[model samples]
Target: MQKKYVTIASFTAALEPGILEETERYLAIIILLAGFKRYRSWRVPIAIYGSALLFGLSHLGNVGWNGETFEATIAQVIGVMGSGFLWAVLYLYSGKLWIPMIFHFLMDYLANLQSGWNSAGWQFNGWATDYISEVLMVLVPLIVTIWMMYGKRREVLEENADRLMNLPVEFNRY
Candidate 1:
């Protein structure tokens, strides 16, 4: 049985404000590099994906945290990346932080139930099968997210282009 404290902590971590910290950090970087004028139009997707990747990579420390081997860490990292992307996309699509927060909580709850604290390697018996499952966990959501995001991104770009083209000449004075 999973420890109640661990489970609760894990679930809480999933919904923690720190989850969105990367987005904030990345947004600051994007603003510094691209400025607010380009932030919505060009930097949004970049910040989304970039922060997701960084969020995923940050969890690589879980190897040490969980005392897992490097190989297992790699597998888990792939899955983490997928989860990060899925949550980020959800936030972007819904324009609501709560949506992603709930999903993240569920994911972390499930993960903790399966892996337990410091039981990363022991959670699975067959190493190869575990690795495959981990990879799939990442790939399935990532592929679907990319497909959905692509369509939405195109729509946003087209809308922006039309709005820009239709703007009055005097609007450029700013």
Candidate 2:
């Protein structure tokens, strides 16, 4: 989806500082104003849950090789799942999925960059060689996403014409 790509691209840029939760809320306001508030509905939970589930499943195959204990695997999976919810909220509140997307990208990218990531083969980043390059990649999308959704205007009628025209005056009795 275009939005998903954009989300990935935005987060890939890595421009945002740490205040991720606050950023998401601000972004949500923009989408609400832009009249895309419908995406803010169940979409948030769905996307997050889906992403987390997939992430956990991906780790399942690696359990034996990675030597993770059963308890550790469950806990890790749950943490990853929670990340999905957090990211969804971030996307919803910020009205800019870019940051979360880029953040997500960074997370995935870093994971791939680790020594064992390439062995997994299915999820590997050929272009992101170093931490610096990966970080820059993450930052680009974050900036662009924010810039695109920076500000929008609405034609708001400040005063009602009828109310202005209906002013009445009375003579005071002395």
Candidate 3:
């Protein structure tokens, strides 16, 4: 006897969560910006860091839900912040939410496939390389995000600050 598997179904199931997560996080950024409207110069920084930190903290609940180890969960939270920051910056830089949504979806989908949707109770074996990889995971995206938001690329966010923040007028003067 042979068994059939529905790979497309698994991929489709993975898609919804990524889109919803990114949408919610980005909306939170916009809301943060709106709330800080009076502090025009600090709005972008607050929105990006605030939303990204919230996104990372959200993963903490996964430790309880998925039985993930505390240490592993801590690493995941830190790593996810980098990813969240990168996504947020990508949205700002491209002036398109879909860019980050697609990246987020693809990343989640691939991870799901790699782990076969059975990531519960995963742990680090304490290899030196494991620690190095964990650090790199967090640092690389953070470095990239910082680079993307500075120098020439900063102009992109400045040009679309109003649109990205959902504000009525330009707020990037600061």
Candidate 4:
């Protein structure tokens, strides 16, 4: 099984380095643009938590296909959700996309070591089907949406999301 998995995943090994470097380059720009204030916003964290929870339920197909207990799968989902939350916090507080991106990479890599792929996060256990492989082909960052939604809250993010959205960029619209 490991051999097959390696053989299949090997196609991307050559491209990994280049992809990682390019990802870092873009992340740097994103982080700079995100600024520091957005990090303070709690809405960003809420959205992150939301996405993590929803991502797990989106795995109905895997639970059906693998004959795995929904409870067991949910446990994994919970773990992934936790991991996602951690990544979210790292990004929001650091205002650095690369920070979470690297953490994400390490996570997927280590998970691959454990039991192939699973739908808990961004995929359906690789051993379950080719479907999981395809899902992971694309990576999306939902944290930015949180930042965009909440805008800047330099004063306090604990509850300024609604306030931020209403205020103008220059405080002129108000």
Candidate 5:
């Protein structure tokens, strides 16, 4: 019973981080779009990559705040950049924030479950397996996101670009 309660509590707690991170991602997208508004053709990609970069860098706080090792934090940052890009692509492709929010929640929930809710900071271990896993983590999402954005999928981005940029609907004709 106690174990069940802990599992439930951890599951709920994971949602907090997901909500916070997604909120930050959304704000980054909006800010980037606003800043690059004049670069009409480039605004969407700029927002995607810029926000992903910011999302990745945001993990650096774990080094100081959680006492994570520099190497571990760096790996985490790169891994999350790919995730951020994927989430951003999911958002744009679906034209719905909830899609990415759910993805983020599931991801955090699984991490919390694996770490047993309140585990200590991550360590690099300096193992070959760690390096391989980290590399795959970064590459898989990047490749998948790139695939998602190709061909007709890009049209989804264009269709939603004006709304994302907060421009008037008529501007979408351009």
Candidate 6:
């Protein structure tokens, strides 16, 4: 007799809910105005954070898919904002889309497995625990975003220091 258990294929079955979805959505957001190229300098922060917020907002529809009530949906949206922050920061820091895409894939994959795919909503948890999760989801991302942004700002400043200090441009042969 064969023992029934989850397999890796189970995780890979749902493509739309993970990396592919994130890639499509993020590209949609960035491609319109050449956001990757046009937004530079201090504007980069605004663009990243703003797009992240919109990314969270875009998931509002998933609440309905999860069969969550409006209140839970609101909480979920707040929680998703945190995830958006994390993903945005990941992409911004690496300057690579695949980093966040792969992370998003793992996140959704584990999440669906944990929730058994059928009930992948905050409503599945007790009210208190669900609320706590929502709050934590928001806070964790907020903290990471702040920390990452501070370091990123410093790096940007250092890179620009030569120009700001009117130093001569240095070129390297590849």
- Overlapping backbone residue pairs in candidate 5 total 0
Q: In angstroms, give how far residue 6 of model 4 lies from its true place.
A: 4.5
Which is the winner by TM-score between candidate 2 and candidate 3?
A: 3
Ten contiguous residues with the weakest lDDT in model 4: 153-162
Worst 10 residues of 6 by lDDT: 165-174
Q: Which runs in model 2 stand beyond 4 Å of their true positions? A: 1-43, 95-97, 105-174
What digit string (tens of lDDT, one per residue) describes model 1 on residues 78-140? 766777777766655554556766666666556566555432442444568887888788888
- What's the candidate order when arranged by decreasing TM-score? 5, 3, 6, 1, 4, 2
How big is the positional error of residue 117 in model 2, measured in Å on the Cα after superposition?
11
TM-score of every candidate: 0.63, 0.33, 0.82, 0.44, 0.85, 0.69
Q: How many clashes show up in model 2?
A: 23
Clashes of each: 0, 23, 0, 6, 0, 0
Candidate 4 vs candidate 6, lDDT winner: 6
- Give one digit per residue, the lDDT tens place, for model 2 in 93-159: 4545566667765665455444323212232233434334434443453344334322220000001
**RMSD values, in order shown:** 6.3, 16.3, 3.5, 11.0, 3.0, 6.7
Where in model 3 is the C-alpha error above 4 Å? 1-9, 118-122, 165-173
Which window of ten consecutive residues has the lowest lDDT sum in model 3? 1-10
Between prediction 3 and prediction 6, the one with superior lDDT is: 3
Q: Kindly list the per-residue Cα lDDT of model 4 for residues 6-63, writing each as its tens digit.
A: 5335434323422453254334323433443354433344444554455444444445
Which candidate model has the greater lDDT, 2 or 5?
A: 5
TM-score, model 1 to reference: 0.63
Local accuracy by lDDT, each model:
0.55, 0.39, 0.72, 0.44, 0.76, 0.59
User: Best candidate per lDDT, number?
Assistant: 5
Winner of 1 and 2 under TM-score = 1
Clashes of 4: 6
Q: Which candidate should be chosen as best, given TM-score against the real structure?
A: 5
